[model samples]
Target: MSLKKLETLSTKLLLKNPYWEYKLDNYTLPGGQTGEYHYVHTPGAAMVIPVHDDGTLVLVKQFRYLWKKESMEFACGGVKDGDFLSTAKNELSEEAQLAARDLRQVGEFNPFNGATDEICRVYLATGLSKATRERDASEEFEVLRMSVAEFEDLAGKGTIWDGMTLAGWMLARRSVSALLKEKRL
Candidate 1:
């Protein structure tokens, strides 16, 4: 059976920004049903789990205007007109001022599957070194370091509620665990 959007019924842009656009995609569903997918259209994004050689992670706290408070999250940002690996390195350097020799692409996942088609690429970054730090005009954040065990505890206790941070960690940790299982750690 073939089910597809017969046509674009309409496109209404809710908001336009440099990185993303809030829009509605109206189409005919597979079963000849009328449907709309309201989602954020974006160039996508990348997240880095910056783990130190000793398994400590570098995290960030930033003031997100929508949240109206400093929110804790891992270093991540949108991939602005670049490949995932390049964006990952740039984000690592920009957010935490760290450059990594080992940047393993862990996996990819949709951050908000129901509402957005935004795909986030996750990476496990090790072999860290200092890099020149620069911030985007709207950026505001702080850096913090902690062990993986501590991070897991924090997540378990609901201290880490940022969707990107939690989701990115889940993917990256799976890769890390696989490495450990094969005695590759």
Candidate 2:
């Protein structure tokens, strides 16, 4: 049997907040069955992999209230008004206290396709320097710099478990390796 796409009959707003909207969608399945689906709708997000001159990565260790534990991840933030690069740069500065002279978009991914309509654009930021922007008042995180190998080791051992960070790294690691090999970054 061939599968078909779902047809959304209607969407109801269950809740709305500054960050996202909880939605209840009524749809007709390919099998001619009607059902209700709940999901989150968002304006999307951006994540930055900040690589230093020596090929080290700048990450942030922050407490995740939902998870109730500290997590380490690449600088990331939600896109505002559909500006991906600006959000990436702002997030880099805000989360890691660094600015990039060159920022290249590596790739994009949907972190939680089953639950949300949030696509995250990933960027590779090189030519880094310290940024002097004030951190967000509600944000508290520690910036960390580590070699690529060390980062891989930590990731391998499951120390770094942020889905966005892992997804961004998967998209940008090859470009990072190529730049390092060519001494371009």
Candidate 3:
């Protein structure tokens, strides 16, 4: 059976912030059922998997307020002015203090489609060089460099729990493995 789509009747803004907007959407199902769905409206995001010249991955460890613990993740940020590459570059510099000479789009995914309209574009960044980091006033991170195997182990053990990071890694895992294999030779 083909699934019917929800027809949105109206959308109410519940809250607004500089980052995202919370909205309530009233919709009607094709079967004559109506319901209200609340979700976050976002401009989307971009994440970068930075691989160093020696094939180590660049990541960041930061304290997540909601989780009340430190979380390791790839450099990522919400899209600004609807530009994915610009956001990726800026986030990579700000969060990891590294700039990539070769930045290529890997893939995109909806991190939490059921709860938010956020599509995060994942990029594979290489040809890295150092840059001065300028983090936001509310942000603090410790840059880390680890091998792909190490990252995978941590991710498998539940140490790396950020959905965006996991999605980004999954998107770039094959490319990363190839790069590591090439570098080892």
Candidate 1 residue lDDT tens string, 1-185 = 95553677898999998889999989876677888778888889999988776667899888888978777788888888769899999989999889999998889999888787789999998889999668888897788998778888988898887988998888888766664456544
Instruction: Write the residue-wise lDDT of candidate 3 on 120-161 in tens digits.
Output: 999999999998867899999999999888999999999999
- Residue 122 error for model 1, in Å? 0.2
lDDT of 3: 0.93
Please provide TM-scores, in order, for all candidate models, with all chains considered together.
Answer: 0.86, 0.96, 0.96
**Clashes in model 2: which pairs?**
none
Q: What is the lDDT of candidate 2?
A: 0.93
Query: Which has the higher TM-score value, candidate number 1 or candidate number 3?
Result: 3
Give one digit per residue, the lDDT tens place, for model 2 in 1-185: 97678999999999999889999999998888999999999999999999888888999999999999999999999887899999999999999999999999999999998999999999999999989678888889899999889999999999999988999999999999998888854
> In model 1, how large is the Cα lDDT of residue 120?
93
Task: Estimate the Cα RMSD of every predicted model relative to the unseen true structure.
Answer: 2.7, 1.5, 1.1
Q: How many clashes does each candidate structure show, in the order listed?
A: 0, 0, 0
Q: Which regions of candidate 1 are displaced past 4 Å? A: 1-14, 30-33, 178-185
